[model samples]
Target: MRRGGRERSMGFFEHLDEMRGTLIKSAIVFAIFAALIGYFMKEFNEVLLWPLHYVQAEKPTLVLELGTTTVMEGFNVVIQMCFLGGFILAAPFILFFVGQFVAPALTDHELRMVLPLVFMAGLLFLIGASFSFFLLVPSTIRVSIEINELLGYTLRWTPGSYYSLLTWLVLGVGAAFEFPLLIVLLVYMGVITTAFLRKYRRHAIVVIFIIAAVVTPTPDPVTQTLFAAPLYILFELAVFAGARVEKKRNERLRAP
Candidate 1:
């Protein structure tokens, strides 16, 4: 159905059609960005591979001479990195399409929150990816290498594997960092109250620790804490954001 079909709700086929249209538009936008970014794959590869290079040069921990076991591995890594770069760069527009799809169903308060959230969402993703690249991924790799050494196995890691791991870790952390927006959205929609967040603060902290452990890939407490710290802070920020919006919503409700 169309955006404002109130009298007659959307049938299944109509919903499917709208979803298909949204997917097509999203794909077109992604393709354009991917093609442009793919042209600059070299620069993108350097950035993505920084953690590996840094660990190798600085620590001299392991002879992680990144190799290509397959004839096409080099070309494949370039393609993969290009698409990953394109996705990271194109995230904002992708979010815009998402916003467009959801805007019609939003209340005034939610509509107002959308722009800031969109911007924040992108910024948060970058921060998260940076965190993973600069610290978490490197530390995890170092620890893994140490373990392999202890087990008396030499690591002949391939380029494809390295970039694959990097892409997933960076993107995973980035996507995980969007949790505050979820919290704020819930508040804007009156789904949950500030009191609930406050009441479950301890439980939230425990869950955050678990998430940190899962995301960091390193077993050490320090590395886990590094991941957990920002997450806890983000959760607190979510609480404050939600509270502030809920207060505004309450004030507007009492307005003349």
Candidate 2:
């Protein structure tokens, strides 16, 4: 019993040590990417400003001139963008280190399942972010300008504020795309099955629309629809996928 307690304590401390090492490695990789991205400020700036260009191309009437509100806001934007760029560039390594720390405790089947799910989640997030960057942001910008114009207000945007909005829009939309994965995971874990999803589908969609309304940076119908539509579609897909997984799980259970 004493030996067992000592072994358990050692295992706990070992895991903590592993997590610490993984974090240190991730930090190192992130720092390297931060330096590289910071050095390429011009390119990064161009990419960051593409949504503005996208809006301008479609709307000649919109007025947009981003300014700094503070003495150091310019540098602050630079640092923030650089840090974001670094995280984006180093995402794979970061995921890897995180996975390494978690993988040891998982069973072989769970290990196999986790990696592909992680990859899919990451891929879906990037797709959602790109969708926001290229389409949603421009539409939001255009709609916001139109609404402000209707209210008799002139457009004056600060660089810091604009960039912050851009970041949130991308991240929020990216996160919005991740909900279906959660449903699928829950199905796999047998917490709830496809029937539950189907039964509550209407309520789920209403909640999704509410979430979309809240999450969309601009409260335009178009953006909200864009957010809600895919979410509903993904929920449908999740239902089908969940049904299939449930069938297989039952089959395996009955086989033995």
TM-score each candidate.
Answer: 0.80, 0.90
In terms of lDDT, the best-performing candidate is 2
Which 10 successive residues of model 1 have the least lDDT summed? 1-10
Candidate 1 residue spans exceeding 4 A from truth: 1-29, 60-62, 97-110
Residues 15-126 of candidate 2 have per-residue lDDT tens digits of: 7888899989999999999998789888988888998888787778767788887899999999988788788878889998999777656667777789989998998899
What would the TM-score be for candidate 1 when compared with the true structure? 0.80
| Deviation from truth (RMSD, Å), model 1 | 4.1
Clashing pairs in 2: none
In candidate 2, which residue ranges exceed 4 Å CA deviation?
1-17
Q: After superposition, how far is residue 82 of candidate 1 from its true place, in Å?
A: 2.4
Please list all clashing residue pairs in model 1, or write none if there are none. none
